[model samples]
Target: MKVNKKMKTSALAGAALLSLQALPASADQEYLLTITRPGHLQVIDMSTNEVVRTCDVPGKFGTGSIAPSPDGKIAYVLSNMTEDVYGFDIQTCDITFHAAQSQGNVRVKTHQSITVSADGKELYTVQNPVRHLPDRFEVMEPQLAVYNTADGTDAKPVRTFPVDRRITKIAATEKGEVILGGADIKAIDVNSGEVRMVTALQSWDRGPEWLPPDAFAMHSQGEQSNEYIMPYVTAKFQDDTMNMETAEWWWGISRVDLATGEAVRQEIIPFEFIVFNFISDPRDPNIFYGSFNTLSKHDITTGETLALYEMPHTYYDLNISADGKTIYVGGTSSDISIHSSDTLEKIGSIQLSGDMSTSDLRVATIRD
Candidate 1:
């Protein structure tokens, strides 16, 4: 039986409308979508920074991975409670559909393993079991499951195929291919299921000691000013020599060229601070942002650290507006903190109706 979830709008103040009306309107609407840890969704009006609507997700312990529809009218989330996926209408803040990622003793979703295509017609995610009890659970090879968004409530994978064993995050390209980023970056042909490796996270390593990536650092992969940004941290390179052990573990950002499939690594000056999420400036691709416990700005061009600010709490997710002005950070709290992207200054905060430990904040465009 599906669990009963609450769906309601927060008590928005009338004065809030007056403030929202003051802002100049655009052809497209903007909203901050927050998925809480208590398993709920909150859609906040970016104009007033107010919670316009909220819906309790079906799953209890929801994962931090959601992809907004092309129109931003709906969000398809890969949930973990019972290992299923649910779609919520962005307008009504109600459950629109529910489809299990795996069925009958099978499970999926490692972390941030869900994303929609560029055109927003399909969904992609990695299916990995959570438990490995010998007799109680049946362990299976990890696979990539593709589903059609139009399928509605009982949606099932139109096609399922084996992908890399450790793909934690999934994204798509404009040219009609799936980009899986984790320990290694690769492309897969949806129709043909051809996996082509683009590059490894340790691509910058000069010696044979290749460092595996911290997959938790990955967020949604989207084009910003014609360039794609990927944030990831690498595991330590343990060596008996004191110099190697004392040497800081390098964090990196991968910049990929969509046109030519050329991927380059931007290694940060070793261990000043750790950045686990990626947010790049739309106007200037050279400039990028990263956050987990702290928000950081980086100039990948000259390998220089620009600014760093500690967030109130450790946030697992981050998002930026289409105009490249405001930065939204959520995922581990009831409030979505807003900041000036240019300065990383706290500009405002929107408190959710419930203390829904929201996970991922996805910024997308909604049509008026």
Candidate 2:
């Protein structure tokens, strides 16, 4: 995944440098985990299992992952069909920002993920772009843009680095660095705007167990050579009891070191296809946490995977407490569950008014 050493200078010349000086000190933080289902954002309070409020979103409940600013004041929602990203004020419940694609040669086909910088000045959006013109071998490139937060306006493209492969996930590191992964993971220098393929990850070999039992977890590779196709239900299982139930199905977790272009650790996490959206131990950058049906804690330094917690089955999204003491998971096996990060024990669970489905959980901590 390492870039050619010769291209380093040209790639990162005079890009905006990341500033964490303004970032507030970490403290006991609470968050609202939003899960999408029929067509609502189930806002669950982490401190107490209570539906503090339910916000109505544009598309289906979970059109795309939801992200809150580090300060916890603003939340951004993306749409699968539209090119615009919506902003919500957590305190006033008002839509403050409506960030649209202001500049670009092509229209964004699928709006994937929206991440914000640590200083809360910019919103980084990752999207797929297609040329407006027809067939001339027009390329479909992975687009990245930085939108100003002062006003819900148009975003400008900072850099559109070439990634000819599939990018399934995009995340902002604790230090305000952007990490993109699909069949492979790449770390882009936020300040310098240099994108380096961090680690090369090979896709799982397809087989019978990879397909779903009732057509719920069908797997397919689009556009690429129709060389491999399998159902998603045939996912590998660790805990057989939960594996029998469709509610518990997850791919796995892998973390790569940006300094070195290699995967430090990887584990086959049980549960449905769920993307982790929370920092496990914010104080210690190496420790992070996430869940789908089961909760996990991974240490990138030592490359160790530990079963931190598990649920009754249904688990959608999660966010870490500001201080990294507790994890708030959105959904219902029977109810929404909150677990202590240190002990990995269930502290509380509460039922929500909305039904939870297979949706990626996005969470952000705000200083209260």
Candidate 3:
């Protein structure tokens, strides 16, 4: 009986120790990976804001975007210049999924169009038609290609479906619908290949004076937004006498909920201020941070601006932390400009050692 009691105590102690080991580490120990042009990637420690590791990748250009795995173990980078999709393992520093061509050896390319399914089993990329002649390009039907992420390198699209051209960015909803970002937002049914126009900036019930512009540019649009994602655009009202060349444009943000398909559009600034991407803080939904030439923090609840400031240089990409602590800015330089979420002050920077151009800043939680 004494021996049985001792065995029970030993098992309890072992279970207690195992529970301690299973506890998650503090968020302070997290890491972030920032990619730069001319083929370089820097993984930085978020706690210390210091470089932890670096890797050089070949066949990279400035026109590519990365989609990180949900577990943050891998990053799928789509490059238009190389016409290839590469899966980069952040932990092991191994590169796989080197798909350079589509069906029938046809060279395919993408421009800031990539996303991975929630389960991390499928990868999606937009394949744009190639330019056949100078000043004139061929008009092959644009398509969305879906590949099995686990297949790696030589993976081909298990299915290809028609998609409209002029799609600048890509994101997915929980229901497997693809959100196509452009002048107007569209939701494409992946299985049916049906394109539905959910939200057009002009479709909103604004007055007759409101005008939606012809183009919208967002650098870091392929991100994970639990609420929704919106791209900043410039459009304004003009007087009957005002010429199109003379009228100033106003900046605004329009977002559509993936769950309900409801959209909301509101003007942030009344003048022509450039904004690349305007993403909100989930911790505080009213507060949003974005960039164009300046890193700005604004509150949608209050008409008053929160904070707007210049950076070390111009940047196009900006992402607010999940906890709303830091704003990671990239897309134009070799540094990930880190700033305080409240004060908008320049605190620290992740500077690279060489001449590089950074694009698309994303913060992922690395899972064990």
Candidate 4:
């Protein structure tokens, strides 16, 4: 597809150069940031469970992946068919930064891999570029693109390095590395571009008794827990015969600590159903929640189901409140459902103007 120069120019002229405004002032408040179809960023106040503010996102909306700055002042969204990145000031709803990944005949897609540094000075993503020839398309190598947040409106990658393909999620670590989740869990240094194995997912050494696990980590809701957690499913042979009928399927979790870059992987429970996403409890280390067609609570340490409640519909992503009292399920519909963490019961819901699609439901704490 070709670039829309007129739309890009108009969006830049209207959003750029706007002065930042003060949000409803508060010493410390938790808000949920999410995007919906047709391009809109909505902020929900955790205290009132209401859509407190709505911001217009520039460019066409497709896979609206958002990564908020450290201070929660700016939200960088990957939109425009996953080829453009725009940073919106949450308070003023102004486009603070914009970067179109594609150039000329090469079309680049980030594939939902976007993140910001801990200090909020840099942004990172893995770009898969394909060159469109007159009669054929040439596949190019994937690279990690890093952008400075201060470069407004016409931002470009300050640096880029080659990386492995199929990276779907990127999370920054406090130790100057970004944890990449895809075929395997790996950490790449932002400065040196040094890549190291954090944990083996597809290449896990589980002996000849277990089948390789299948997992996908897309949502970026680890702010409250300070960890990137993902759910997976695998089957283990129950006997020496290694018969398919005697295999026991199980659910497991792999976690990467954002502060230390430490990784942990373990099977959690028997695979009973599919879970699209999972979030750990900030208040309790042993507790976590999963969402899809149902809301289920699990004991991370014991691999036990603590509580389970069927939901009204499917939700692609789920996040926890800072206080750990309420759980919010979103990303598959117009309404984000609120539930009690202790009982897993629906308590309330926040309805948006449009469907969330594959957008992330991120919890950010804004301070005065």
Return the top candidate by lDDT.
4
Indicate the worst ten consecutive residues by lDDT in candidate 2: 217-226
- Candidate 2, residues 168-259, lDDT tens digits: the string is 44556545566665554566666667776554444444343432221111111110110111112224434434454454354334443322
Q: What are the runs in model 3 whose C-alpha is more than 4 Å off?
A: 1-30, 80-82, 102-105, 131-137, 202-208, 221-224, 232-239, 242-249, 258-262, 355-358
Clashing pairs in 1: 35-358, 35-359, 36-357, 36-358, 37-357, 37-358, 331-358, 331-359
Q: Pick by TM-score: which candidate is best? A: 4
Model 1 — TM-score against the truth?
0.82
lDDT of 4: 0.88
Where does candidate 2 stray beyond 4 Å? 1-29, 60-62, 80-82, 101-107, 131-139, 153-161, 173-177, 190-193, 203-263, 266-290, 295-310, 316-319, 322-325, 331-335, 340-347, 356-358
Candidate 4: clashing residue pairs, number: 0
> All models: lDDT?
0.70, 0.53, 0.69, 0.88
Q: For candidate 3, give the lDDT of residue 232.
A: 50
Report lDDT (Cα) of residue 313, candidate 1.
Answer: 85
lDDT for model 2: 0.53
Put the candidates in lDDT order, highest first: 4, 1, 3, 2
* lDDT preference between candidates 2 and 3, better one: 3
lDDT of 1 at 238: 51
